[model samples]
Target: MWVERYGPKNIKDMVGNEETRISFLNWLKDWKKGSKPAILIGPPGTGKTTLVHLAADELGYNLIELNASDVRTKDKMTQKLGPTLSTHSLFNGKSLIFLDEVDGMYYRQDRGGIEFVQELIDSGRVPLVMAANIEDDKKVIKLIRKSKVFRFRRVVPRLVELYIEDILKKDVAKLSKESIRLIVREAKGDMRAAINTAQSLAGLSTEELSSVVSSRNLAYSLKESFEAFFNADSQEEAYKALIASKVPPRDKVKIAYLSVINSGLKGDTLIKALEKIGEADKIVNMIGTTQEWRLLRYLDRLLAYSLFNTLPKGSVSYSEEDMPWNLKVRMWNEGKVLKDIGGRLSKFLHISSREAVSIFMPYLLVVIGKEKKSLERFIRLLGLGESALKVMVKESERVFLKVR
Candidate 1:
């Protein structure tokens, strides 16, 4: 990928956020035992992770990096990080502990993970650094209180364009000035995305470029697409909006369902809107189950004309969905956890993982949370850590209340 191929090699080579980069380097240079850990927070594709890796190289520190995928149970964290906190490197060099995406720690599955890291930061021998996409997350807020926080803002479009231009020059590739402008504008300050788009357009003819640009420029985020669909003035406009959206058809239907239910559309309108959304959802599921992709074209009309037509007229309004970065990260992590839970339950029940997850896991969690003894027994049998157990208990409680 261009993102990796053209990634910055050193601190000075990075683009934008020059002040924040200097702050990061200064923090590293002035590091001492028990100095507050420096946490770099920003949006993805903005070079936060790259800066840390570059700074570690430039400052001659041996870096021990951990990302969100690392199991962060208390025991696992202690076992992996304890020695790093207490001892110098074997080569007699400084060691830096860099935790990337610290915002992914779900309170249930990462119980005590943050606290343990905090303890290490307070009195550890090695200098520590962390990175997360969002600063306002509750876990990140807790991290900020004990750390020197440096925020990496999005790289402005001009800087991103310059970086792309330099790369294009090196590749001996060419694009129309208009194409470059379109790519930079559509990238919305994401340097990695801008570079990737430029790379993909490297060899296309100018005539072909406009169509690609138009399609890409029309790629609204899930939230933006839903907003456009709800606020569109005509059926044709709504249909065009849905067709332009980059979200998959299945997820598009879900977004429509959530938007309508949350929009406070009531009585007959609510019933009609739900009926149309349900029909679209069924078509999406059928396509998934049968591998019949040809059915996808109908989804646009169904969602746009059939479903959106039920909206009450004259300024339908609803709050934007609160799909924060941390929440999306948490949902992904939860899916992985659920898959693991399903695998374990499948073996015990002599069923498939999908069956265990879709059929058995919900009820199992409810039963486990309701009966303390069952919870303990299952934890021991599954070798679940405190974090996983907490997740199970919380999910179980939710299921219990819904059923009741």
Candidate 2:
């Protein structure tokens, strides 16, 4: 809710990206009288929504907002929103219709999604505003061309900390500087995240939080969580983090498997790790496809593999051609994106995530060049990047050049 509470109000409170803010301000001035809707594009928590509303408020305009979850049928668009959108004057007298996370529509791609907005722009009734974490990639060339796009960048750490501390000093008077440091550092350049981190820590421990300037979770941080779970001294800690980690069992298994493997685990111990992951995946697949609720027990088994398993195999090695840092980062990014793509694209099609991923991922991973570019765009839209996305399948279009 920090995003709600401290989200930059009136555009000026927003930190970073002076040019973007100015561009948006200029667009706001002439958006009516036939100019197309303005689009705010950027990463999540970058204040896209905040900027839009602040602009509207500063300009004294009434806001009507819609998200993908809304029924945006052509009939709905043309019949319902299309009328007042233009004829309306400004703020009670002036009104702006806002569509947020516009790319998050649930309907089929062919169901007039991008086209619907284009039609609305062509109508030119209202000065519209759109907020999405996207940019013109090849897949949406038309949208890229028609809208006046503005980018929002992440709030830097120093400014974010200042904002949070200012709010905290008012909301709760006793927060220590150490705690403030942790909250700011953990925020990872996200103001909302920073606020939430501060809030979470404040609730848990009153200790003076420190270590903000300290080197923190590295590019390879998630792997450490893997090690913590699989190599933990107790199941309790392992169980807690695993259940809470965003990683699903398939990758949990793979991550834990790879980490254990890296530590020189082999033979029965190695097989044991594989078996645990295998079971986890089996159940995960069941949940994905069959909606089998009873299979939840296997998710626990995966955590148990990390927690309860004893005397991990393989002596941990340092010099034996370690996984490259870039590759590791890519793999992690791909895992999240693939999993999300599975779930999200499925919803858009009214299919299951399991089926969605199985159907589309192989194609994306195997194809290169333009095809890869399109898939990559989709990945960026969903806010995912990584290596868990694999070139595991062969596509019919071209033979892939194998790289070492």
Candidate 3:
């Protein structure tokens, strides 16, 4: 894969998040027994794990990396790591314990997983580092508060483009500026995805790009699959495009929704298109919850039908990098607050957390902001703390700004 083939050779070779990278390096350099563990929180392909490996190599610490999600139980994790955590010496080479995707450990399934990790941090024997792609989970928030949390923003598109260009140049691969732009835009700050897509298209010509559906690797790329679906001349072609896609059914629904919303369609057209997409999404979710794998057969046809004639050809493009990095940071910082609100609202209204955030929170915040009594009542009812109230106030302000 291009990802491994073009992997950073050293810490300096890594692109973007320069400040965080330096801070992380310094943390490793200065690490000692009893030093606080560090956690890297960010989206995928943002160099969190890669930074750890590179730092371990350059700093000469024996690297012991594990996926927390894979070690399902507290007992198992302890069995695997307890010995290392308790033993260290100058005679023995220094060791770094890196737990990747710590946030992915589900407490319900992996009982006391975070608690064991907490205990390891207290041991303070090894230089510990953890990374997570999400910050909103309650256990993850607990870890964040205890550890030295370093926030990583998504890599800017220009950097990703430049990096891809460098890789292509080194490999003697030729790609048009238009093709490169499409890959970068579709990659949406994921360097791994960008490189993988570039590798898939390395030798293809511009004419081949249009008919890339005939090629399985090209069809497997989510961006190309979406493009093929949107531009297909007939319903069968659109359905075939969806079938050829390697993207999961649930993700297909989500990408389709984002693509439609960002496509600049308006009035009834947009409304009707979203309605169909929503229908598909509901079915997808139902199939997941019920574990009715047979229902998946209808998914491609449904998605193809959802957008068919919904817009003129190529009007609805893929939209992955819609949110700005600054806004993304604000969202991450307030993630726990949002999760709290969603949890409370979901229980009170008997809706899912997703619905609580997407459907209720905005309007609820607006109403409470305008009416002091309602705000008081809601805070009391939801048991919302100052942090949640602060989030509510900020979100209400956003609503008002948009309204104005």
lDDT of 1: 0.81
Pairs clashing within candidate 1: none
lDDT of 3: 0.83
Lowest lDDT 10-residue stretch of candidate 1: 315-324
Top TM-score prediction, candidate number = 3
State the displacement of the C-alpha of residue 317, model 3, in Å, after optimal TM-score superposition.
Answer: 17
The 10-residue segment of model 2 with minimum total lDDT is: 388-397
- Candidate 2 lDDT tens digits, 185-230: 6666776677677666555533333333232322223555555555
TM-score for each candidate, following the candidate numbering: 0.56, 0.52, 0.57
Best by lDDT: 3
lDDT string for model 1 (199-241, tens) is 8888688768878877766677776676777788899998887
Ranking by lDDT: 3, 1, 2
Regions of candidate 3 where Cα sits further than 4 Å from its true position = 90-92, 203-206, 213-404
Backbone clashes in each candidate structure, one number apiece?
A: 0, 20, 0
Return the number of clashes found in candidate 2: 20
After superposition, candidate 2 runs with Cα above 4 Å error? 1-3, 89-92, 109-113, 136-141, 205-404
